[model samples]
Target: MTLDLPLIWAGLIAFAVLAYVVLDGFDLGVGILFPLIRGEPHRDEAMNSVAPVWDGNETWLVLGGGGLLAVFPLAYAIIMSALYVPIIVMLLALVFRGVAFEFRWKTQRGKFLWDWSFAAGSTLAAFAQGVALGALVQGIPVANRAYAGGWWDWLTPFSILTGFALVIGYALLGATWLIWKTEGHVQRRAYDIAFWVAPATLLLIGVVSLWTPFLSGPYMARWFAWPQVLLVAVVPLAVLGAGFLLIRGLTERREIAPFLASLLLFVLCFIGLGISFFPHLVPNSVTIWEAAAPDNSLSFLLVGGVVLIPIILAYTAYAYWVFRGKVNAAGGYH
Candidate 1:
């Protein structure tokens, strides 16, 4: 049987994006919750929790962007043109956070500035990502294979709401992560923050889920249409189940379960998005096959990907394994 190279590439790209979101998201959340964490030691503890893996987590983003450029150039061109502002903002914020990561350890009186920079950068990056997601979900106007929308089209009520949702969601991930990796006051504060943040995050998720369907007829039908709805509609209920686990794990004081449940919630939401955008690289615009590079080009990349993806995975897994377990003030790599 012949392989569907376009479809395969689409799945790979989606997997990379999801990996970036789930992995990088929690660390960003840590930065977003920086203000609530008091004391230099505590803040340092918070940052240290993710210090080992934060930079490595972004590898998936590079893979996703590069894959999109090489494999689906048309979709990349269109989406990039549409989302230049938010995408640029995200990159800048990421840079600021990265700087904060290293510089915060080196400075004395000026360390506070770096701390704030980390928080602001993480919050902005998460919000910008959410806005980009909302804009894409709402749809980009394309005419003659070019972006036909206004510059400010991405700034919408729905997009704003999504932006808030992601910020809160990432914060929840951070809090849960802290609960898993910290102790004493930092852990207590993380639990407290998560106690409120969890519900708030769930509410935002519900709002976004409700708001998503009415954005487009295809989206509505994808989730709500008869027969198919039977399957897609289960996602919300599954989210509720996942929420239950998050709360249950928190209440029971389980270390890892809450974090896993939080991740499950994101995974389910991502699956819903994937389902909604199936077959369309540009969401109701460009089909995957239409947007993909030639088969020969795809095959060339696939060969390299076969070797490179595994190496990346092996290194990533090794990093996490080497640095596994609780990250207290005394322990954990700097």
Candidate 2:
């Protein structure tokens, strides 16, 4: 079968977003869960769990944004323009969180401040991303590929709901990561959080589903239409299965199983969103084909992907392989 460039680009974008969600999701989750962790020892253990992998995980985010800028300039410009404030806030939060991660280890006196910064920054970044997503889904106030509304146009009820939902989602991811990385008290606490957070995340999904049709007219048609509805239904069912598995694993004290199950649930939910917003890159404002860059630019990006993606995968795998053992207080960030 012939390759449709638009579809291919859409798939690439989806892959990048999913990679960001899975890889960076855990670290962001860890940040949000930071406030709940007691004492310096547990905090170090939590930070160490992601130290080697966290920086590398952020690489996909760079690639996703950069690739969009290069390969889909129109969409990039429009999205950035519409989401200017939120994106700026997200970047600042990310920067603050990263700095806190480094400085908290070195500074002895201001540790509490750094901890709050990290957690607050993580929460801020995650919420901004969710709001941006909601705005995109709800269709930005656009005309002629330009934002036609005021600055607060993105701050709808739908966006706020999505913001909180994403926080819960990221927390769930972090809890799973903890289950995989730490042991004893830390692991137990993480498991408990996972058990509780899973239901909340599911509820958020339900709310988004219920709210989408009312907020966007096309959502109901896209979701409930014949064969598409069946495909969409599969995602929620898969999420439920994963949730069940996660709960069972946690109950049985199955160690790594709960984390894996949670990761699967995240992937299923992401897939569902991708399907829900297939052709639209800027929601109803612009389509993938219309927003895409020239074929030459795409070809260039594909070439870079050939070299960069494998290296990223290899390094990530090697890091995980080296850090396979359980996290402990003594596990210093080298």
Candidate 3:
């Protein structure tokens, strides 16, 4: 069988990216919501809910970045150059958040400092990520396989709006997660936040969805053109359905349903994005076939990719299984 190696690698990279967003997203959500929860015990319980898996959740980011660099060096180079500032900011924030996660419990006097650090770091990282996504959809200026835009190219009005939308979305996810992983007052507070945040998240999604089609020529065609139109049209309906399920689940107070529903909502959004830019790695700039590395190099990397991806999947599943259940202040990382 002739392998469409580039397409395979593209799919792998996309999967890794989606996995990172959905996985790390909720934990980051937890950190973002930390400031509003009131008191150490509640915040500690929230931290405990994600402590075991947050670091592991970020592994997909490495996988996504490494896969891009290895599989599509041209695209990677152009994208990294275009997104350098936000990417750097995001990484630094992640580092601060990780350190805060580890050190918060060690000192009684500085716990509040660490807590603020964690919240600030998570907020910045999430905003940076959304900005990067906005920049991608806003379209990078690529010429001669190099980034052709200035440092501020990524900071458009659309990008800023997307960043705020992501914060609300992540907060909603974090609230649903708390509902899934905690009991008593913490869970109740999560429910309250989620009830309001859910509608707000959907509203932002609607604004972004409506605004997106007009921003790029390809997206305009991808979302509105004939056959492509019909096939792509289901995304919004699916998002609506997912949102409905999430809202209903929350109202019913079913622990896992709301979280799963939120996940479904994200997955549908990811799918819609993947569909909108099927073969294009940089939207109007580059295609997978155009950006892919040499076949021999991809073949060599494929060997490791085939072996490693499944192992990562297995371990990720195992970790969630091991850590599944209610979390409390006393149960947190110490």
Error of 1 at 161 (Å): 0.7
- How would you encode candidate 2's per-residue C-alpha lDDT over 101-153 as one tens digit per residue? 89988888999999999999999999998998887778777787777778888
Q: What is the descending lDDT order?
A: 1, 3, 2
Each candidate structure's TM-score, on Cα atoms with residue i matched to residue i, is 0.98, 0.95, 0.98
Candidate 1 lDDT over 253-308, as tens digits, reads: 88889899999999999998988898798899999999999999999999998899
Off by over 4 Å in 3: 332-334
How well is each residue in 211-272 modelled by candidate 3, as lDDT tens digits?
98888888888888887787777889989999999989988988889889888888987887
> What value of lDDT does candidate 2 attain over all alpha carbons?
0.84
Which residue pairs collide in model 3, if any? Answer: none
User: Where is model 3 poorest over a 10-residue stretch in terms of lDDT?
Assistant: 325-334
Considering TM-score, which of the candidate structures 2 and 3 is the better prediction for this target?
A: 3
